[model samples]
Target chain A: MMTALLVMIGLALLLGIVLGYSALKFKVEGDPLVDKIDAILPQTQCGQCGFPGCKPYATAIAHGEADINQCPPGGEPGMRALADLLGVEPKPLNAECGTPKPKSVAVIVENLCIGCTLCIQACPVDAILGAAKQMHTVIASECTGCELCLPPCPVDCISMVPIPEKVDNWKWRYPVIEIKSLAV
Target chain B: MSLFKFHGGVHPPEHKLKSTAAPIRSVTMPLRLVLPLRQHVGNVAKLMVAVGDHVLKGQLLAAPDGMISAAVHAPTSGTIAAIEERLIPHASGLPDLCITLNADGEDRWGDHQPLDYQAQEKSAVLDALRLAGVVGLGGATFPSHVKLRADDAHPVLTLIINGAECEPYITCDDLLMRERALEIVRGIEIMQYLLGAKHAIIGIEDNKPEAAAAMRLACSQNSISITVATVPTLYPGGGAKQLIKVLTGLEVPSGKLPTTIGVQCFNVATAYTVHRFIDHGEPVISRVVTVTGRVAQPGNYEVPLGMEIFDLVQAAGGTADDSNGLVMGGPMMGFNLPSGHVPVVKGTNCIIASAPALFAPQPPAMPCIRCARCAEVCPVNLQPQELYWFARADNFEKARSYDLFDCIECGCCSYVCPSRIPLVQYYRYAKSEILASDKARQAANVARERNELRLARIAREKEERAAKHAERAVGARAEAGGDAKQAAIAAAMARAEAQKAEIVPQNVTDLSPLVATEIKAIDARRGKVDDRD
Candidate 1:
């Protein structure tokens, strides 16, 4: 009986090795689209896309579930870029999440802020750096301008202040190409 | 065609109770008006009248610049207040070249000449239609003359007047057919004459029984050959292709016009506009608009092009409690205005002051499980699942290969997705991106070809010069002072070359990797998550 058990174990090990070798030899190349979508999205942990985060949203889009236009923060250009990647026609950004405005970060008026955590909780990307009792400060560079944090501030202390235009941040809008579209 | 249609259409709840039964109503001339130059599909019309210029109703304000464009005229006697870039009814909220007018209230007409279209030849009718600035009033705003002039190779045999106002909550066209059936018939006759078609067919949806009865009565009275056929009240059964299929019993081949099948289509209103343009010498300046959806009052309104969305809302008795701004056109194809400040355009069909109750605000979109529902509902018979896959993966090549360019972006696939995936948006994005890439590729190709020609030109010129120099041997010694002068010249040329090399080539590094990595990484991760979902 001991010899029989040893033989069974040896056979199982041998089978595993052969299967693993075969799997490694004939692996399918992953979709290159995943990389293209990930590149267009602003890598913020913004849950505004309804996905857990930007990365997840990109993945969902890759899988054919999520549309490229849901990210209001990405605006029309981003939608176009995603559309170009996906080979779909781009529509206007879904107006449900609000119109795409110029990039803005919710600024907390320290004097007016009631030290409430409402704004903190409203932040989809957690770009606001603060505690419950402390006046919140916006991480300007990290904010995606989704405006999620502005509404929940009980005191109305948060306002979407537009990012100051500077040489560093000022990039020309990607030139739009004329597309021949029929009235669909 | 299959029993079920294709992707991206929505069944917005029909709120036709208010205006469906109500007859079409004409309103008093708006005191002020904004007429955009680029109201149609082509180039912006050249401004013919400007600030302080007095003009009567029917006076041309902007003249067509391109062959595929239309001219603009005053809806009422008015003084031009300003001509500048103003917000027009567009989804992107971009400014358009617009002419603002303050009505004089005289509402006087110019020396109008209503013609007898039957007496004239087809070219005469087309010329008259062009001069009057008539276009397809079915919201496409395409030049009517262009459509009327069918290709000789595929001569048009029939005229299809679309009366299928199948969009929920909008009843303007239904109201028009019910109230002004005879005028519509007259319009159909004019379109028939213009195209020299064998017959004309008016397609009214079954839902509008009153409209069908009216059209049939009008057709019988005029002894017109036009047939009023009642089609199913499908949301986009009114769409050009769908209507053509329903009428002709033949599908329009993909990427080709209905004219290819010897059929040409125009909206009922467009026929009327064409009639008025040729017979009565009237330009397309005014048409019917339905003011409804989440408002205090709703009705069919005849409004001029470039009327403000806000004014339309006000005319409908102001907004209800849950007003969420406005969507111009039917809920299915209409777009939410960025601001109510945008004025109406030629394509403005209905203004829906939406609310969460009527037009439910979207919730979080969950991941798709590849159920293929989007592909199933698509009227265009497109495989939306495959599109979504390539699009999400950003594999544009694959998406294009799947005929992503053919997607009409009708918002039907996105509307029907059980997971609430916004499929129309994806198609739009893909289309735009593909266009941009294609343009880039074209420009690059043109540039490369041009550069190659330029280099070859330089080489040819060098060879020709050498041959010419060889023809004159003695002049070579005279042309150059000895070896000392040649050495000096060579040194200067070397220095100039060195300066150009140091300043130019190194500065322009290939950005493919930097960009490919920066954007592709985020996209790949997005793709990866989609795989998991």
Candidate 2:
């Protein structure tokens, strides 16, 4: 009986040492769940999710402080991806934030801009190019259609222009599969 | 010779005799030629000519933009009318940048000279071919120089010439082999010399006996020994991978090139152009196009590049009265031309005037019965039904895992599908959707990285500003020489005294008499309240 007890204690000690070493050696640096949630976000930096940007929203989601469906730019598909990652049921997008729309880019009317530099300060991606008292222009490729610059423009020169589908960016649509009844 | 068979293939009715009835003829140049910059399978060629520039026949109108791209040349002497977006001969039916050339009718050749390939370095020969704008004339217009490049690391062992011409209603390569076998054989010798290949084999479908016989005779006459093997006539047998399997008994690993196995395949017409560029000093100015199905004259014509299909139909004695529309390739794989005005590109081997009688519209697709007929006929040995299910459900990951990209879209599955489902269309949709989503994911990753970098930069700037302010404060304290607090108090007191001196009651002097009386009464009441407090 004593030998058996000693064997059990010895085994427990060895396993405990191994487990302790592994915990120390393989310790993660940061919250990996936050990084994963960030990856699923569209990174529009639009702040429709009641956070400053996509990363902060991702952090909130990771911490259970925010819902997965708060991002309008990400839309339903992104919500579903996040739900899949977090092993939760997907819910409908929160309509209070905004409705999903086609991707667009900000176009600054150079004549009406007035060189106020308000839109430049509002753009989170730094896609707008100008200095104070200078004509500003938005780099269409880099503009995430965040629409943050819209409210700050005193002259209302910034407009959201939907990107047109051309041969280069055109995508193939889903195939139409008819569900015929077998009774026929 | 012992030939190996691939996993799955179908035998479609051979409709080639209709076009092979007559020898290849040259068509008259159209009034205007619309040449798209993206005829090959790579980056669009860089335009070299401006509007109103006069170009001679075979003059370089656009140069290859990068590796794996082909140069574009003038088919006939012409003046550039416009460089604008025009409808191109593509399944997408989208308009892209095209150079509209108004034919000058001079057909003058530019200054050119044939390359003495034997005397020059192999790289020089390949470079000359690239400048000459030679490409595979078989449906896929991949640049020929890119394929001919053989390095010591992957030395080409065997060269396979594709004379299979297996697609129904297309016989451009068949006629080329029958007539210009000598030139093609000579071109094969040049490719062999460049690749340093041990031997070359020309695989022609047994259906075209005359083409096979001519190739055999030409091979005998040539100094280099080239074997002429007759592969079984099958739909999509001319596909590079399929033909390689028949001739070499080797399967190109999925997602890998045939060059990985030391084998390279070139279309027969590509060889003819290589011969013309190396010997006769000619670029790819024209290609043999088969105009068949519902036409008065169904024959192969050596049509100049950029000639509109509408004009080519006229050259072929016009279309039949019952002709419904024009298809740019074989009925199995071709798509209907958006309009007859689409021009002939380097890949335009045939133009079939499809009619209700020729190609009946498919009946509405029925639900799959799980029959394996599609699996039996798939040339790439893929499960079409499963891919169809996954695609219909928008499960692109599942479709990708099922090897959806391995499908060649030969239409054999759709041809044999009992339910009349457009299986190939589903595969095409799934493949394109996967590619688009992959692209979107990459873009999102890039945006995330850029956003992180910008945030880092902003934080760094803020820290630097804080550091600078701290440094200035430290410097000010050092200048005060151990009396910094006292100096700050003195400076604050002096600022207060300056504020006292600057203060003045300007409104008190400017008030009207009645307003001044009311102000004085209010001030007397306030003084009484203050005295009470």
Candidate 3:
């Protein structure tokens, strides 16, 4: 009986030592999983998902503190991808954040810009190019059309416009939706 | 040369006799010629002539924007009335940028000079071909120069000329082979030399016996290593990959091109056009197009590019009273033209005047019973039934996994479908949706990248501004001399000391009794354990 007790104690001690060593050997600094989740986000920094930036949202997602469907900008495909990655069921985008809309880019009415720097400070992407007391312009190519700058622009010169489709950008039109025909 | 057969191909009835009996007749130049800038599958040609500019025959209206595109030229001496949007002959019925030329009726020629390819450099010959606006006269209309380009990594072992005009009611290629077989052979020789190919194979459907004989005779006369190969008469046998498979018994791997397998294919009519451009100094201004079905006098005509289909139909002894719709290509692959106002482009091989009697309308669709007829006739050997299901349900991921993009849209599955599922249409829809989604993802990625770059740029700017501010302050102090620097250092040290003095530690005596008792117990337990050790 004494020998059995001793062997149990000895095994427990060995297991504890191994666990301690592994804790030190495989120690990871910071949450690398959060970074991975962040990499998949659109990075608009729009704050529509009730977070300050995409990184915070990614951190929440990694910690299981937030649902993957909260991002409307990412749309259904993005949600599906995230769900696949997380091994969870895909859900519809959370309507509380916003609905997915057609892609657009911010355009500034050049004549209407009042040389205010508030829009520049509000822009998360720094897409606005200007200096103090200078006319601000949105770099259409760089702008994410997040609409964050619109709220801060006192003059309200910024507007979102749909990108025009050209011949090179034209895609095949979907045919008339018809069921299988009986004709041969 | 021995030929091989492909999988699951249907033998469509060849109606070449309907138009092959008549020789290629040249039609008079139309009053107005409308040339769409994007006739070929590449970047649209850059506009060279502005509105209201007088141009001569063969004058360049637009220059090729990139290597994959072909130049656009004036079919005849004309004045540029407008460089505006016009209806292009596509299934979408969308308007594209076009150059409207009002013909001057002079029938004049420009200063075009032919090059003796044997004496000239290969690159120079390719450049001449590019300038001549030569493209594949086949339905694909890919620029000829791009195909003839040599690749050292994948050397061309054989060049196959596609004479298999397998689509029903399309006899342009057959008639061209019969009339201009010698010129076509000359073009093939030039291409073979350019590509440095060891052998050239001319693949013709067995249905066109006279055209095949003419090509064989022409090839023998040339004394080149060219073979007039007879392939089985099957729909889509003229597809580049399909013809390559038949001629060389090789399968072009999915997502790869025939060039990767040391083979290149071109239409026989394209070869004839190349000969005309290189030997005669003529541009691709006209092509033989078969106008049959529901017309009073159906025949092949050498119609100039940009002529309206309405005029072409009229030239074919006018459409019959029963003619209701017009199809720009063959009945199987062609789409109904929105109207007759659309102009003929380089890819317009045949214009079938479709009617309810001639081309009967399909009955109501029935649900798929999984009969597998579509799969049996699929030339690419895809599971058309499964693809149809996935495409209908918008399950693009599954469709993509099944290699949906590899579908050539030859309409073979649709033609053979027992349920009349319009399988190709669904596939096209799925393809477009997938493409659109991919584009969206790309746009999103680009936005994210730009945003990240912007963030980095902003951070750098902030750091630089802080550094500049510090540097400016230091420079100002230095300019004030040594006394000022010493005084500033003393002030900074005093402020640091004052800030440090503001922070004080809380006294241990202020702790609550409960916390103090817990700390004492913890300390006593630790002391007892230390003593035991």
Candidate 4:
């Protein structure tokens, strides 16, 4: 009985040491769950989620501080995707956050722009290009359709223009299938 | 030659005899032509002519924008009316940039010389072909020069000319082979030389015996041996990969190009255009289009590039009274044109005036019985039922895992579905969704990178500004040599004094007499307020 107890104790100690070594060797640098959640987010950098940016919101969600359905720019599809990833039930988006709108890019009314650098400072992606007292133009391709630049513009020269559907960006719609109800 | 068969295909009824009854004829040029820049598959051509500019026949109206794009040429001498968005012959029924040309009725030719391909360098010849706007006329409209480009890794061994014309009611390639077989053979020789292939084979469906005979005769006349092998008639047998498989007995790996297998396939009509461009100095200004179904006189006519479909139907003795809609391309893989007013594009091989009698509306889709009928008819050997389920559930990831992109959307599975499900439509939806999501994901990644970089730059700038202020503070402390706070207060006082000294009034001299009187009254009131302070 004494020998069996000693053997069990010895095995436990060895297993503990191995586990400790593995813990040190394969230590992850940051919260990978936060990164995964951030990847699932649309990365619009819009602060409708009551956070500074998408990454901060992702961090809050990872820490259980923010709900998944708070992002309006992500819309219902993104919430569903997050639910699937995080193993949670999807709830309707919070109506107070804002409603989802079509994708748009900020267009600067060049002549009306008072050369204020506020819009450039407000942009998260550095898509707006201008200097002090110079006309600023938005790089349409790079602008993530974030409306952050609009309110900061003193002259209100920045306007969010919805991107138009063209042949290049056109997508095939879902097929229509009619299902007869059996209850009739 | 021993030909290999693909996995699955369906046999649709051939209504080609009605269009093949007569010889290919040229249609009268319409007064107005509307050419869309995005007729081909790749990037739209860059416009070269402005509105109101006169263009001659064969004049380059737009140049190819990229390697895969093809140039657009003026069909006849015309004045450019407008370059604006107009309805195009597409499944989406959307408007794209189109060039409207008003024909001058002169029927004049632009200054163009035949390309001496044999004497000129191969690259030069390919460039000339690209400039001449020669593209595959077998409905894909892929630039022929891009296909003819030689690759060092996979040296082409056999070149296959697709004469299958497998789709029902599309007789453009068939009639071209019958009438211009010699010229097509010459074009094949040019392609063979360009690709440096050892041998060539012409694969025609057994249904077109006359075309095979003509092609065989033309091949016999040539010094270089060109084999004309007639394969069994099957739907979609003319697809580049399918014809390549039949001619060479090799399967192009899924998602890989035929060139990777040392085999290159070109439509027979594409070869005819090459010959015309290199030998006759003629560009792809017109193509033989088969106008059939519910039409009074069904036949193939050489229609100009941008002629309206209504005029072409009129040229074919007009559509029957019962005609309901018009379809571009064959019944198997074609899409219904938005309207009869859409212009003829390079991909417009055949225009079918479809009616309720010719094509009955499909019945409502029913649940799958799991009979596996769709699997039996899929030419690409993909499981259509599984793809349909995933697509219906919006499970694009699952559908992609099932080789959804490999589906050519040939409609063979839809034709064979026992439940009458629109299986191809589901696959198309899934494929497009996958593509759009992929594009979105890429754009998101780019935005994320840009945002991160901007944040880092802002942080760096903030740190630099702080460092510079710290350095100035340290320098001020060193210069003061005693109390830092006292020196800072003295500097602030000096800065305020300088600002007060630099103040100037610019409106005093320019003020009008009435404004000056109002200013004097305001100044007197301000002096009384200052006295109370």
The Cα RMSD of model 3 versus the native structure comes to: 10.4
- Between 2 and 3, whose TM-score is larger? 2
Instruction: List, residue by residue over B1-533, the lDDT tens digit for candidate 4.
Output: 89899878888999889999999999888999999998888879999999999999999999999899889999999899999999999999999999999999998999888777889889999999998888878888888888899999988999999999999999999999999999999999999999999999999999999999999999999999999999999888888888888778899998888999999999998899899899889999899999999989999999999999999999999988899999999888999998989999999999999999999988998899988888888778888889899999999999999999888888998898878888888888888899998998999999999999999999999999999999999998787786777788899999999998999967799889999999999999999998999
Q: Model 1, DockQ value?
A: 0.03
DockQ of each two-chain model: 0.03, 0.44, 0.32, 0.65
- As for TM-score, the candidate ahead, 1 or 2, is 2
Task: Give the per-residue lDDT digits (tens) of candidate 3, residues B193-245.
Answer: 99999999999999999999999999889978688989989888888888888
List, residue by residue over B362-416, the lDDT tens digit for candidate 1. 6656788889888767877899988986777767779898888767666678778
Per-residue alpha-carbon lDDT of model 2 for A1-184, expressed as tens digits? 9999999999999999999999999999999999999988888999999999999999999999999999999999899999999999999999999989999999998998889888887888888999888999999888888999999999999999998876667666665666668985
Model 1 residue B259 CA deviation (Å) reads 1.4
Off by over 4 Å in 2: A111-117, A131-134, A177-184, B482-533
Model 3, position B3: C-alpha lDDT score: 84
Estimate the Cα RMSD of every predicted model relative to the unseen true structure.
22.4, 7.2, 10.4, 11.0
The candidate maximizing lDDT is 4
Per-residue lDDT for B378 in model 1? 81
Clash pairs for candidate 2: none
Q: Quote each prediction's TM-score.
A: 0.65, 0.90, 0.85, 0.89
Question: Model 1 chain B — which ten-residue stretch has the worst lDDT?
Answer: B1-10
Question: Which digits, one per residue and each the tens of the lDDT, describe model 3 over residues A117-170?
Answer: 898888887788988778888888777778898888888898999877665556
In candidate 3 chain B, what residue range of length 10 has the lowest lDDT sum?
B443-452
Q: Can you rank all candidates by TM-score, best first?
A: 2, 4, 3, 1
Better of 1 and 4 by lDDT: 4
lDDT, each prediction: 0.76, 0.91, 0.87, 0.92
